[model samples]
Target: MELHFMGTGAGMPSKERNVTSICLNMNEERGTMWMFDCGEGTQHQILRTSLKLGRLEKLFITHLHGDHLYGLPGVLTSRSNHGAETHLDLYGPAGLRAFVETALRVSEAFLGYTYTIHEVEEGVVFEDEQVRVLATKLEHRIESFGYRIEEKEKPGRLCHEKLKALGIPPGPQYAQIKRGEDITLTDGSRLKSADFLEAPIPGRQVVILGDTRVLNKTIAFSKNADVLVHEATFGQEREALARKYYHATAAQAAHIASEAKAATLILTHISSRYQHGEEQTLLKEAKEQFENTHLARDFWYFSIPRKTASHS
Candidate 1:
């Protein structure tokens, strides 16, 4: 899976960064893309990339903040124009349905496709054969939420050499053994499927948090995540101001990742105050706390690697 950052700025648009928006590309696995936090100018950012707006199947809003959701109307209209005739699922806070509906109504923007809005609570909001999405309440200025996406474990690899050694011919029976089904051979011997299959590889987990202050509970919430995407609106020097505004500093975000034992930490929602020369300092500060930390820039994409069973 790949995470494509359309916008990474904290509050408003700047010369260097836009607001908050990310597209999780699952086209290779699920033939669709999932979006998180559509901010202002998000569609414009998509235009800069090769992402097709019609492929966006789901939109998970974090909160009701203007900076987090101001781009929804435009994106929806554009998706309709781009021929997204199927239903689009939207999940967010309690007032999300009202906000989206009102904006579309007032603007008289008619969509060719139907849409479903789900006001989420702190638990599993979406699940299918391939993945499950869970949400937890975050400590922010408003009733914000953090999302954890869990990809289901894929089938284990077939041990072709083992099958050959067992004198199993390359036939339809090989398919049954790969599926963990025991079958009787031509010699009246029972073929054990387990011996021909490798151990199941574990699924990956991605935690994406909305704007929030550093909370101790996050450590457990994000435990062992393959990728933890957290907002770093300021540096350690501005901790006091960050807390007052219900935002986290770069050092704090790294600390959370370290405590959670997350494999990687991506710091986004950067403040525009840090100009070209100064932005590197934020990444440096975060790396000091957690070596696996990375600063997110606009239009950057992160590919999440799968964890094999042997590694665990």
Candidate 2:
């Protein structure tokens, strides 16, 4: 899986960054993409990338803040205009449906495809055979939420070479062997499926948080995540300001990642006050606490490597 940052600025747009928007690229995994937020100018950012609007399957809004929203109507309209026929699912706090419907209504925008708006609560908001998404309340001025995405474990790789060596020809029976089914060969020889498979691969976990102040629950929610995306809206020197605005400083974000024992921490939602050249300072502050911290910029791509059974 890979994370594509469309915009990473906080509060408003700047020359160096836009606002808050992220796309979880799952094209290789599920042939679709899931967006985290659609801030203003988000579609413009997507135009610079190779991402297609039709590939967006789901959108998860963190809050109703203008920087976090304001682009929903345009994205939806554009998706329809582009001739996308697949259904889209939206998940967010209460009032999301009203906000979207009102905008579409006032603009006279007609969607060609159907959509579902799910008002998320503090729990598992979405789940399917491949993945599960959980939400938790976050400490922000408005009602915001953080999401935890857990991928289901994958089955082990079938040892095709071993089966071939055993004089077994490729056929539908290979699929049955991969499913752990023992079968009798035409010659009456028994074949054990488990003996021809490697260990099962472990699932991966990722945590993405909205704008918020550091909280204890957040640490627990992000525990052991392979990738933790948290907002670093201010430098460590602005701790008081961060708290006042219900935001987090780079140091504070790193603290949570350290406490959670996360494998990698990505700091985003940067304040425009810090000029382009000053990003290394914020990154340095986070690295002091957590060595594997990264400062995200617009259009940056962070690939989360899949964990193999041997690695797990």
Candidate 3:
């Protein structure tokens, strides 16, 4: 899976960054893409990338803030204009459905495809055979949320060489063995499926949070995440301002990642006060608390590699 940052600025757009939009590209795993937020100009940003509107299966809004929203109508309309007929699912706080419906109604926008709006609560918002998405309340100025995306464990690859060595010719028995089912040979000999399969591959977990102050629940919510995407809207020295505004500083975000034992920490939603070169300061501060940290830029992509069998 890969995370594509369409916009990374906080509150408003800047010359160096847009607002706050992120796309979780799961095309390789599920043939679909899930978007996190859709700030203004998000459709414009999507035009600059290789992402397709047709593949956008689900959109999860963090909050009702304009910076985190305000682009739903345009994105939906554009998807329709592009002839995307697949259904779309939207998940967000209570007012999200009303806001989206109002915008579409007022603008007289028509959607070619149908969509569903789900008012989320603090629990599993979505689940399928391959993945499960959990939502938890965050300490933001408004009713914001953080999402934990957990990929379901996959079966290990079949040991072709071992089966060949056992004189098991290629047949329907291969599929049975791959499903971890014991099969009886033609000679009435029992074959163990476990002996012909490698260790199971563990699923990956990704945590993406909305704007918020540092909270103990965040650490627990993001435990052992493969990638933790947290907002670093201020520097360490501005902790007072961060707390007052219900935003997190770079160091605080890093501390949460460290406490959660996250594999990688990605900081986004940067304040425009820190210009092009000054972002390094935030990165430096976050690195002080957690070494494996990355400051995300607009259009940046971070790929999360799958865990190996041994690690599982």
Candidate 4:
């Protein structure tokens, strides 16, 4: 899996950054992509990457904030122009459906593919065979939400050596045994798969939060995340302003990462006040609390490696 950061700025666009948009590339696992927050110009950003609109199967909107959703209409329109014919699923808060419907109705934009909109609350909003997504309300000036994406555990490798040692011939029967099926040999002997297979490999977890202020629940919401993507809209010195604006500071974001024991913390949604070299200031502040923290910039993409035993 890979995470593509389209726009990393908070509130508005800047010369260095756009607004809030992210894409989770699941091509290797599912041959599809999932998007989070489609800020203005997000479709343009897609042009700079290898992302294809037709492969975007799901969109998770955190809130109705313009900075997080202004690009939806254009993106949807573009997807149709690109001949996207598969069904698309959208998950968001209550007003999201109304907002999207209004935009499409007013613009008269046509989508070649069918789509479904789901108004979500604080609970499991989506789940399939490979992954499950959970949503929870966040403390923002407006009603916002955070998402936790969990990849389901994968089956362990079959102990081929063990099976061979037991005089089991390798053939189609071995494939069935590897699927955890009980097998009866030609000699009327039973072989149990559990005795020869390793433990199932635990899957990775990713937590991405929307615009919000720091809260104690943040730690619980992000517990054990392999990658915890949090917003640091302000610097440590702007704690007062952060609270008044319903935002979080870099230090506070790192604190949550540390408390949650996240393997890596990615800070984004930077306020435009910090420009150019000034970004290091926020990075420094966050690193004081969480050592394995990185600052995200627009157009930056990260490949999420397999979770190590320590991270698991």
lDDT scores of the candidates, listed in order: 0.92, 0.94, 0.95, 0.92
Off by over 4 Å in 1: 164-172, 186-188
lDDT of 2 at 258: 98
- Identify the leading candidate in terms of TM-score: 3
Best first by TM-score, ranked: 3, 4, 2, 1
Please write out the lDDT profile of model 4 over residues 1-312, one tens digit for every residue: 999999999999999999999999999999999999999999999999999988999999998999999999999989889999999999998999899899999988888999999999998999998999999999998899999999988767788998889888789878887787889988999988777777777888999999999988989999999999999999988999999999999999999999999999999999999997798999999998899998999889888897533322
- Candidates in order, TM-scores: namely 0.94, 0.95, 0.97, 0.96
lDDT of 3 at 242: 96
The Cα RMSD of model 4 versus the native structure comes to 1.7
Model 3 worst lDDT run, 10 consecutive residues: 303-312
Residues 195-284, candidate 1, lDDT per residue (tens digit)?
A: 777888888999999999998888998999999999999988899999999999999999999999999999899998887858788899
For model 2, residues 1-312, the per-residue Cα lDDT tens digits are 999999999999999999999999999899999999899999889999988898989999999999999988989998998899999999999999999999999888899999999999999999998999999999999999999999998779999899899888899888998877998998999988878878888889999999999999999999999999999999988999999999999999999999999999999999998985897899999999999999999999999999979534
Compared with the true structure, model 3 gives a TM-score of 0.97
Model 2 is weakest, by summed lDDT over 10 consecutive residues, at 303-312
lDDT ranking, high to low = 3, 2, 1, 4
Superposed on all Cα atoms, model 2 deviates from the true structure by an RMSD in Å of 1.6
| Model 3 per-residue lDDT tens digits across residues 1-312 | 999999999999999999999999999999999999999999999999999888999999999999999877889999999999999999999999899999999988899999999999999999998999999999999999999999988778899999999899899999999988999998999999988889889999999999999999999999999999999999988889999999999999999999999999999999999996898999999999999999999999999999998533
